[model samples]
Target: MQVSPVDDSLEQTELRGPRARTRKLMLDTAIALMQKGQTPSISDVAEAAQVSRATAYRYFPSQAALVHAVVDAGLGPILEWHSDSNDAEVRVQDLLKTSMPRILEFEATFKAALKLSLEQWAERQAGTFGDEPPFKRGHRVEMLQKAIAPLKHTLTEFQFQRLAKSLSLVYGLELLLVLKDMWGLEFEETQDIAAWTAGALVRTAIAEAGV
Candidate 1:
């Protein structure tokens, strides 16, 4: 006399399996193209992933969304990293050790994504494009704040923010572009230099704070 209920949401998810796979394929294809220093449109991704343009549009809705998805994926471990240690220096070092290699691995891909954001900024400044939503960048500020949380009371609010911002300058994809690309340093050398620079920043900031 009793019957079990079939969940409608579960049923829909079961039916959407292939669609989910296709979406992932398109995203992966987009990242692959970007890794090769190419900025691919959704249509290009669809072609590369063997999906239809209509379906690709259904997944991403716009070029900005598609690129954002790829760039988000490119962030990898750095975006979700957390540290249990309370030592600010140790936390900063661990963050750098975990993130730099991943960033270096996808150097071209991240740079291409950065290039798109920069180009959009320029176009917006020129008043040639104003309707579309802007591409959102990373969460470096929050992460940096967490890394240096122990220094909050030691330093002034402005000093805390300034130190974090300075550390961030040598932390992300810019580290690759600056030390490796601009200075012509080798990979290992670049990592060493970044670590040294970030350590010095932390030391000087703390010293000046009298902590």
Candidate 2:
């Protein structure tokens, strides 16, 4: 398991044993509150988690940090996804099949994070958010690139990148919402379409690249 940029945001510092557990407890508590239709503050999470405010603050400096942590947690396998195959297309197929469903499973948690992000965006736009870091969302780039590593020599760098970027259209919480909510498809149908669409994109890229 190589070090990922996500690990830094997911951990405030090098956490150990009991401290790691305590941090996880706060994140879990925040997630539970979000699931129940409430956006909890850092103080709120501290109280519900029965941890000291100072300790909770130590783990998560702000509500934004807490929510970002939950969203990243909701991403599950995607953050640390691994595949042994050197076949680019197969790796992507497996990655999407494994991760898309997990994305839907915690849709609400991700959606809440998105909502907070949007609210933060509006505040920033209105010059009220101060110097807070923009609520960043992407954690898929490295894994996606790795999934298609075998294609590196098969296509121009630009073409390979385009294929990987196209995959975002078929994965992630937004895609699930578009399929299940907008298209009104069943879960199986939604996943099937996503997987199918992903395959089509990969095949098309390969074909276009004459590989």
Best by lDDT: 1
**Which runs in model 1 stand beyond 4 Å of their true positions?**
1-16
Q: What is the lDDT of residue 12 in candidate 1?
A: 81
Best by TM-score: 1
The alpha-carbon deviation from the true structure for residue 174 of candidate 2, after best TM-score superposition, in angstroms, is 0.8
User: Stretches of candidate 2 above 4 Å error?
Assistant: 1-18
Give the alpha-carbon lDDT of every model.
0.85, 0.83
Which digits, one per residue and each the tens of the lDDT, describe model 1 over residues 1-211? 1238879998689567987778788989999999999878778888998988999999998878998888778876677888988778888988889888988888898888888888889998898876767776766777788888888888999999999999998788888888898999998998898889888999999888887
RMSD over all Cα atoms, model 1: 6.3
Candidate 2, position 186, lDDT: 87
The TM-score values for the models, in the order shown, are 0.88, 0.86
Q: Candidate 2's residue-wise lDDT over 1-211, tens digit each? A: 3455657644655465688889889989999988765768889999999999999999998887888888877776677788899888799989888887787778888877778788888998898997656677777777678888899999899998998898877777778679888999888998888788888988899999877
